[model samples]
Target: MTAAVFGHDGPWTEEEYLALGETQQRVELFDGSLHVTPAPTPRHQRISRKLGNVLEAAAEAVRLELLEAVNVRLRPGRVPIPDLVITEQVDLDELIIEADAVRLVCEIISPSNAATDKVLKMHYYAAAGIEWYLLVEQETLTMHLYQRQGAHYVERSVTKAGAALELTEPVRATIRPEELLG
Candidate 1:
């Protein structure tokens, strides 16, 4: 499938923006503009859900929270719904209503969103000061992990079916591609 194209324009408020969501293409309000991309296919969802479950189960003991496709506010009104998020257990009061940022952010890559997930979104996560960022490539069925190094991120490990990706504090379990992409 081809990528979804959107017209470039000034940023809009959260209330005024998501209400104008387009039916022609999938779009995200990034920094205020409509960052568009084609819809993810079934295979993409399978991989994403698979990994989310693994991460969630592994984090149960530590009380680390697993957020799935939840909108997060970075600045006053800036928001983006990451595919997966790992964070500390905090009050639900400000969630979904405030600009709450998490410590770790992760995304599953689809063919139509390869660039957005790998590049644009990566930069966005860093700019938000997230500690760890993860990229899961469904095409290759592997996980690429990164950790912030003084405001920048260093690619820590790339794990395949035979191996596992190590997680951060609170969630000490490792994730395997077989458990994620199978």
Candidate 2:
């Protein structure tokens, strides 16, 4: 309930982490450690919603599903709530979606979490064997797409505000960064 409850000396177990239940903040578990982040800004939410709508249409066409801010358990002791995830149809009643079911994960990168989204999460997602990663920059409205190769991910494409990004894999969708804001 309070910060003090999460300040113990030992590493947190997956059971213990999940037992905390949902809070207003975003909480993630990585290698027995918990990382709590503040809720996203309004601008970030706008981008997520618009982009999700686009992806949802594409996913439905391909029989895939697009989920927003869901718990994706990459592996034991590793769970991160991706901004948007395109996954194979999953049981609606399940509390968590496993890594194998995920096709692509997206994150809206704001100034406050630039390093975490661009670097830390990128590595973890790839390591979990998720095929694709999408990052949307909040300030410039730039979008970066990455594909996994071996143990890491390589940049597939980058689309700026005025440009449209054409995605061929996981699902087919054309997106323009500027359009996400409006």
Candidate 3:
């Protein structure tokens, strides 16, 4: 919490990271280091909001829950704030949400951070036992849905701007990728 360099070497803990308080920038923990990401762009936020809305109705019908841009604590040194997290309902009084409760995690890829969203976070989510992960590309309005298979994730579907994606894994829903843009 006290002023210190973020992304420091070796042995960082979640308690120390959480004490930093509310910050304008988004921060995530991986491999005992902190990774700071700037707040999402307006377009990014819009896409995230739209996706959450569509997923919300589907989740409601099934009695599941959806949360946007929430912190998911996988372990002591591995908390990642995903763009949109879909999970079973939990007590609002809890301070942290565990990874096991998360059924799906979605990331709307920013141009500058595509690798992290597409590659790194995919690995993290699968390793954490999340059954579904969605990657939305901003420029093309393409959404890639992955389903966890064994210890890895396999691409289940890819929907472009005009197409509707039908998902049956983490939840059952039909989503048009372009709808996320406007």
Candidate 4:
């Protein structure tokens, strides 16, 4: 599609946003606005792959699925593609995973999108009633875990490099922040 089809005039509709289809960048919708981000660095992908491996086993043990970079529809006109999600099994053929099915949403914070991942997405995820939120800091490999309490998220745990992050609510797992680098 041409740039004209995207229309730079008004806030984007869900239909318009989805019609963008797949691009080389990461595109998300929030309150009818489209936020486009460039593809992550190779280091980001490496950390994501390693951490997903660690979480996948824990998720599978409880019959949940671990997905990476999936479209999660928090609501109409609000869809943020989280870096990782551990969720109840849904139809893989579907393009979007509803918010309620998600048990945990994880985002790896790079210097470029730190605020969006740590603050903006945190608010949206908690508002959507997602039970768990995990944040990983790229440079230091620090991990923060939060659980929803009422309309917001409460900080549950923080694990730095060389430490173990033990989680029990969404699934049972122990992760070391440093291990995610390799």
Best-fitting candidate, scored by lDDT: 2
Clashing pairs in 4: none
Identify the runs in model 4 with alpha carbons over 4 angstroms from their true place: 1-6
lDDT of 1 by residue, 116-180 (tens): 87887777677677878888888787888888777567898888778777776546767778776
Instruction: State TM-scores per candidate.
Output: 0.80, 0.96, 0.93, 0.96
Candidate 2 structure, TM-score to reference? 0.96
Between candidates 1 and 4, which one is better according to lDDT? Answer: 4
Off by over 4 Å in 1: 1-10, 18-26, 91-101, 168-170
lDDT of each: 0.71, 0.93, 0.85, 0.91
Q: lDDT order of candidates, best first? A: 2, 4, 3, 1
How well does candidate 1 score on lDDT at residue 48? 76
Sort by TM-score, top down from the best: 2, 4, 3, 1
Candidate 3, residue 89: lDDT: 91
Report model 4's TM-score to 2 decimal places. 0.96
Total clashing pairs in model 2? 0
Query: How many clashes does each candidate structure show, in the order listed?
Result: 1, 0, 0, 0
Q: In candidate 1, which residue pairs get closer than 3 Å at backbone N, Cα or C atoms, i.e. clash?
A: 11-32
